[model samples]
Target: MAFYTDTIDFTARPAFSNAIRGFFTRIIAAQNRSIDVERMQDLSDAELAQMGLTRDGIVRHVYRDIYYV
Candidate 1:
C-alpha cells in the first residue's frame, strides 16, 4: 500500500489580482481626466479663470497628483 499527498500554493493570486485591479483603476482615472480636460477646454477663459485654472494648465491640473508638471 502507498499514500500520496500534494499541496497547491495560491500566495501569488492576491498579488496578481491587486495588480490587475490597480491597472484598471488607473485606466478609469485616466479616462475621467480626459473627459474633465475636454469639458474644461469648452469653457471660456473667464469661466476657467473663475475656477482658478487655465487652458494650458488643464492636463497638468488633472494629473497633478501623478505628474509634477
Candidate 2:
C-alpha cells in the first residue's frame, strides 16, 4: 500500500504559524475594544460619568476581555 497526503498546516507556515496566529490574535484583540473605546471616547464627561467609565478605565476594560476566560 502506498498513499500520501499534502496537508499543509500551521507548522509549515511563516514563523511556523506563530506569527500568523499572533497577528490574528492582535486583530481580534483590537476588534474587541475598538468599538467600545471609540464610542466611549466620543462621549462627553457627563456621558462617561453616567456610564461609570473613565479614560483611565479603558485599559482595564480591555484587560477584562483578556482575563475573563
Candidate 3:
C-alpha cells in the first residue's frame, strides 16, 4: 500500500474591486492610529464582545467587519 498527499493551492484572480483593495491597504494602514474617537466613546460590554474587541484593543484589531471578513 502506498500513501499519497494531496496539496491545494490558490491563485488569486485579479478583480477591479475598490473595497477589497482599500481594506488591505487603506484600512490596515489607518488602523495604526487611534480608533474613531466618537464611535467607541460609549460601548457596552456585549457590543464590544460581539465585535470581538475591547476598548483598549480597538485600534489594534481595528479592521471593519474583521470578524466576518
Q: How close to the true structure is residue 59 of candidate 3, measured as C-alpha lDDT?
A: 49
Q: Using TM-score, rank the candidates from best to worst.
A: 1, 2, 3
Off by over 4 Å in 1: 1-5
Q: For every model shown, what is its TM-score relative to the native structure?
A: 0.84, 0.48, 0.33
Residue pairs that clash (backbone atoms under 3 angstroms), model 1: none
- Residue 24 local lDDT, model 2: 96
Question: How many clashing residue pairs appear in each of the predictions shown?
Answer: 0, 0, 0
Record all residue pairs in model 3 with backbone atoms less than 3 Å apart, i.e. clashing.
none
Better of 2 and 3 by lDDT: 2
Model 2 segments more than 4 A misplaced? 1-22, 67-69
Q: Residue-wise lDDT of candidate 1 within 25-63, one digit each (tens)?
A: 999998999998999899999998998988898888888
Instruction: State which candidate, 2 or 3, has the greater TM-score.
Output: 2
Q: Please, what is the whole-model Cα lDDT of each candidate in the order they appear?
A: 0.92, 0.75, 0.62
Model 2 Cα lDDT, one tens digit per residue, 1-69: 998889756655667588889989999878968877777778898887787877778657656757652
Q: Any residue pairs clashing in model 2, and if so which? A: none
